[model samples]
Target: MNPKISDSIPQEDKDFDKQHIWHPYSSMSKPLPCYHVKSASGVRLYLDSGQSLIDGMSSWWCAIHGYNHQELNDALVKQVNLMSHVMFGGITHDPAIQLCRHLVELTNPKLECVFLCDSGSVSVEVALKQAIQYWDSKRQPEKKKFLSIKRGYHGDTFGAMFVSDPENSMHSIYTSYGPDNIFAEAPQIGFDDEWNEADIEDFKRKIEKHHKIIAAVILEPILQGAGGMRMYNPQYLKRVRELCDKYDVLLVLDEIATGFGRTGKLFAQEHANICPDIMCVGKAITGGYLTLAAVISTRSVANVISGGRTGCFMHGPTFMGNPAACAVSVKNLEILRTGAWKSQVDTIEKILLKKFKPLMESGHRKIRQIRVLGAVGVIEMKNPIDVALYQRRFVELGVWVRPFGKLLYIMPPYIISEDDLNHLVYSLISVATDESLA
Candidate 1:
């Protein structure tokens, strides 16, 4: 442990933060110690108090290349010197255009146009609007409903909350609206003994039943992030793609958490050789620098939303195409293109699997399932109580691992070294073995 940052922060600074700061996802009434970060590089976060913590969750799985990489910072600095902010509604800029070109090249060739937003949740909102409007343009306005897999998480925005599984998170407010636009199933990851041929047939039946009214089928591709890091077989995704096509439903792949090499591929859909009609990506798009999100779609889908005289996608944020953010995103993509991070991701996955296999085989009554995808790994505990205890133990051991209900998972920064990864795994095992958590 180290001295609190408040001890060193100027009295004025502390007063300002205390009076005005209200952080996202935090209970302001019961505040945690605020560690004022001095600087960060690689996978380490340095605090003003002189203590460092390995960013076990990549600052909520956004820092794909760790933090404060010189290349990314230089790109942002260069762009800021030229132009800082601009309304992307009527004007265009080099950074945004270049980033679009690069991202298109990196993604599947089928995806031709990219709509910029400021966050993953907003990108998903854009996708939902586009999908619904596409149906309206095609003279099928009745196709307004969206189907998402059970336990699949999209985001916290109203539109995203409606499409996500209701039981998983704090969605009571959205449900209160009695929105008829979204539908979902309990996640079927092909891991449970209960998952049999009947379950597959039932899922297909559900899709078929809703096919006429469904504008899109939204999912997290390979792994459901907030749905407890639950992973499903690629075959399931292939089937989903096929079913969506067969039913004339657009496939919306929310790669917000799984994108930018987090899943060992540039995109998660590549594992199944499937391309979605609409793709929502964010988190690491700017390498954890500026907030940026993109909604990419095929030319066919873009054309539907592109009205020559009257039709237009009437949605965008003020910071949608901020040049500085785009510049950082371009550099981040360049680093990913070099394939330098491939072996690093592979090493992490190997370490995770090697370390977690024993826990799975240990026949621990508390563990329900273990899942791994690329550099991501998860251990689904038997219940929520155990998950909470596991998370607390992890944070106490100098690693921060948040559990989603019963699902304890890690989506660490790709830049983490072997030693740090080993320490993380040891911490997890230690916590898992504790009867307190079990």
Candidate 2:
């Protein structure tokens, strides 16, 4: 390593980044402060400032086994030496084949076909396209629009953005150009709230009224990320599955954020015990080693698309099945099969609830609600937080937690130690509870 570079990324480097790089939702006129992470291992991010922060966001909820994992690194390196990438046009490889095979077994075994993508958004685009094409194959081209819940976030692509909560999401500005997908009222029933049949009323109404035009009922399953880190009743999803089946609308489950044991189950759809016609899994699929996502579907869906009027699904990425990413993901699945995440997520949830109880019991005025499920813990504020201010505060206190909108949340890696977990939870709660910051 360059001694000068290792000492720090340099003030000029930070200055150059601020001038040139336009980060998510940041403007060039007044950009958000960006930190330089020297390296990462396990649950800590060693920064250029000679300070290490316990990562609470899991590098945006993908590093389930933490960072700089030896197994994942070796897998990626081994595949890279053999061959980094190759055109998937009329070729196949073991890594891609093995990864897809593992994904099918790990998820719903019946979801046999896998469509690899560059990111979560692309996976969603594939899912949306599949639904429309499936209907077209059946000679129902009119069934194009999707039915999605409010406060739901799918992804940032045009197709993904349209299906997300248009009015309340980060992509609202571009909603005018997006497809006019149906948006039912967001689920009013909380994750732990009493499961009233009324909670699913609006969704059911929309499905019934628009069954003819709706191609699919696409949702985030039991847990919704990004738009709002809200969890809903599993029964709501079960009922949604039933309605989709009854109305002849395909069901697409976007398990991007909640897949790979994030929700205590391997997949969030398992909570409802219902298999959708198409499913999107990403984020943690490669254990944060590389960018990869998959749109897995049933044989019926895949066959219909291939034998459709247009022919062969009509879409594919240049890096469709990159060997290195596939090898890393295959290893990631093998490690997950070891079942270590089960206990880690179990303990993390238990400890979060235990530590967060004091805040709930205190009845803090600023706190809107407190929710925990699996490895995710959220403390919703009554008002939106000063993101930049709170972010610096968190760094100063030696933790990395990125809060958005009204949600101050943590989705830490499953392998985080008890001490690191407490440190992160305590540091976050302290900032949340502190009157000076609030």
Which candidate tops TM-score?
2
In the predicted model 1, the residue pairs found to clash are 150-185, 150-187
What's each prediction's TM-score? 0.91, 0.97
Assess candidate 2 and give its TM-score to the true structure.
0.97
Per residue, candidate 2 scores C-alpha lDDT tens digits across 1-438 of 111212466678777888988898788999877777888999999887678889999988899999999999999999999999998889999999999889888878779999998999999999999999999998999999999999999888888999998888888889779688999987863777778998889999999999999999999978889878888889999999999989999999999999999888889999889999999989999999899999999999999988989878988899999999999999999999999989999999999999999888887888888889999999999999999888888888889999999889999999999999999999888888779975
The best candidate by lDDT is 2
RMSD of each: 2.7, 2.6
lDDT of each: 0.80, 0.90
- Per-prediction tally of clashes: 2, 0
Q: Residue 60 CA error for candidate 2 (Å)?
A: 0.8
Residues 1-438 of candidate 1 have per-residue lDDT tens digits of 323553677889977776678865545665444557788888877766666667778888788798888998899899999988889988999999999999899999999999999999999999999998898888888898888777777888888998888765667557777466545455466432333444446558778998889999888987778766777666777788888888889999999998888877778888789999999999989999988999999999989878522388778798888899999999999998899878878888899989898887875877778777788888777777444345446655767666656666777888888899988888866765567654
* Residue 47 displacement (Å), model 1: 2.3
